[model samples]
Each structure stands twice: as C-alpha cells, then as structure tokens.
Target: MSRVEARPIAEILAEVANAVPDEVIGVEFERARRRGAEVWVYQLKIIAKDGRLLKVEVDAATDRLLVAEED
Candidate 1:
C-alpha cells in the first residue's frame, strides 16, 4: 500500500503564520473526512492579539488552509 506523507512541520507552521499571524497555543494532528475521503490535518489553537481564541485547520498534504474561525 502507498501512503501520503505529510509536509514538514516547519513549512506547515510558516503557512499558518501567513494565514493567522497569531500566537499558536496548541497543535495536534488529526485524521478527518473531506469529500468522503480521509485526510490528515493539523489543528491549531491560537490566541489573537485582540484576545480572541481561534481554531485553525491546515491540510497536512497540501499545506492548504481548510478552516479558520474565532473561538
């Protein structure tokens, strides 16, 4: 069987920095269903400078931002 390797963490963090520009509080790797297929994701918990908590998800394979919202 073949496997999809996730992108490097440094690259993922850089991508997140560009998208969020906030202090990341936590990070986790998760397997989720997207378009009915399983995909790997990086779930980030962040704190905005304005004091709002945020949640962000990035696709591990493509370095794409899947979701970002204030929590």
Candidate 2:
C-alpha cells in the first residue's frame, strides 16, 4: 500500500462540494473511512446558507477524489 499524503480533510470536502453546480453556503464532512486498500470514503452534507441541503459521497485515494450521487 502506498502512503497517501494526509490532506486537511476539510479542504478536500470543500473542493468536492465546490465542484457541484451551485455554490454551497456551508459544507460538512459528515464521515470518512478507508475502503479496502486504495480508497477512502467520505460522506458529506452540503447546506446552502438559505437552507437547501444535500448529501453526497466522496471517495478519495492516491490524490484523487470521486463523488457519488446522492440518490
């Protein structure tokens, strides 16, 4: 297993949430875990300052991130 550089999880979460269509007023990294050997799973909740909320899943590994659909 290669050593993955530890990044500020908050930064990663922000990047993922920012990549979404509209800007989210607030974002949270609800949860995260290692998947097998090469994947890190993250569950995020994005909230628009106005109150719109969305949940998304992000998988990160080897300096890469994959965001999954909510539904």
Candidate 3:
C-alpha cells in the first residue's frame, strides 16, 4: 500500500489559528473513510476567549475545514 502525503501539523494549526479567533486547547488525530478513500483529519478543541468550547475538524490531506461547531 502506498502512503498518502499530508500537510504539516504546524502549518495546519497556523491556518486554523488565523481563521478562528479562539485559542486551541487540544487536538486529536482521526482516520476516516470517505467515498471508499481513506482520509486523515485533525480534530481540534478550542476555548473561546469568552469561555465557549468549540470543535473544529480539518482535512489533513487537503487542508480543508470539514466541521466547526460549538459545544
């Protein structure tokens, strides 16, 4: 099997930090399958300056924002 190349975590985190106006408190790596293709994603837990918890997911291979929700 061939390995897929993913973007650097620092780069991804930098982008996320720029886009979101919150502080990233935690991060999780997740593997999922989509349309028969294996995909890698980064799940982030963020704490808003005002104390709200947020969850964000970004595609590792494409650097695409998959999900962002408040919890």
Candidate 4:
C-alpha cells in the first residue's frame, strides 16, 4: 500500500476544472501519476474551440499546476 494518501480524483478534477481557462472548450482525464512519496501528478487533456490541444500536469495534494506548455 502507498504511504501517502492522495486526494480523490473527483475532488482533484473539480479543483482542476476550476483552474482551467474559461476559453477551454473541453477537458479529458489523461492519467493519475505518483512520484515515489513526493507528489501526485494529474494529467489533463485540454481542448480549445480553435482546435488547440494541450496536456497539463497538476499537483494533486496542493492543487498546483506543475506543468502546462502553451503554444
């Protein structure tokens, strides 16, 4: 069993949904990842109306954006 307890995916999704930009047209859950005992990474697939797509990683514990590349 893992020593660190992670926040629920629904809760994380809610938080992430709030953090996402309003212009985003849609969102898809990519995957949930863990780095040893350090952090939980939540990857989201974001889509825009202009046909733009992005993959973002957010920290589950703190609800912080760990990575999001814009182009």
Candidate 3 yields a Cα-based lDDT of 0.87
In candidate 4, which residue pairs get closer than 3 Å at backbone N, Cα or C atoms, i.e. clash?
Answer: none
Give the alpha carbon lDDT tens digit for every residue of 1-71 in model 1. 87665887789998888877889999899898888988999998999999999998888999888888887
lDDT of each: 0.87, 0.53, 0.87, 0.63
Give the CA lDDT, 0 to 100, for residue 71 in model 1.
76
**Which RMSD does model 4 reach against the true structure?**
4.6
Model 3, 34-68: lDDT tens digits are 66877899999999998999999898988899888
The CA root-mean-square deviation of candidate 1, after full C-alpha superposition on the true structure, stands at 2.0
Q: Model 2 over residues 1-71: C-alpha lDDT tens digits?
A: 77654456666665765576544444344335455444455555666455666666555333255554432
The C-alpha TM-scores of every prediction are 0.87, 0.44, 0.83, 0.59
RMSD of each: 2.0, 4.7, 2.5, 4.6
Error of 1 at 63 (Å): 1.0
User: Model 1, 23: alpha-carbon shift in Å?
Assistant: 0.4
Off by over 4 Å in 4: 1-4, 21-37
Which runs in model 3 stand beyond 4 Å of their true positions?
A: 1-4
Q: Kindly provide the TM-score of model 2 when superposed on the true structure, using C-alpha atoms.
A: 0.44
Question: What would the TM-score be for candidate 4 when compared with the true structure?
Answer: 0.59
- Local accuracy of candidate 4 as per-residue lDDT tens digits, 1-71: 65544566678777766776535434444445455445556666777556677767777667678788654
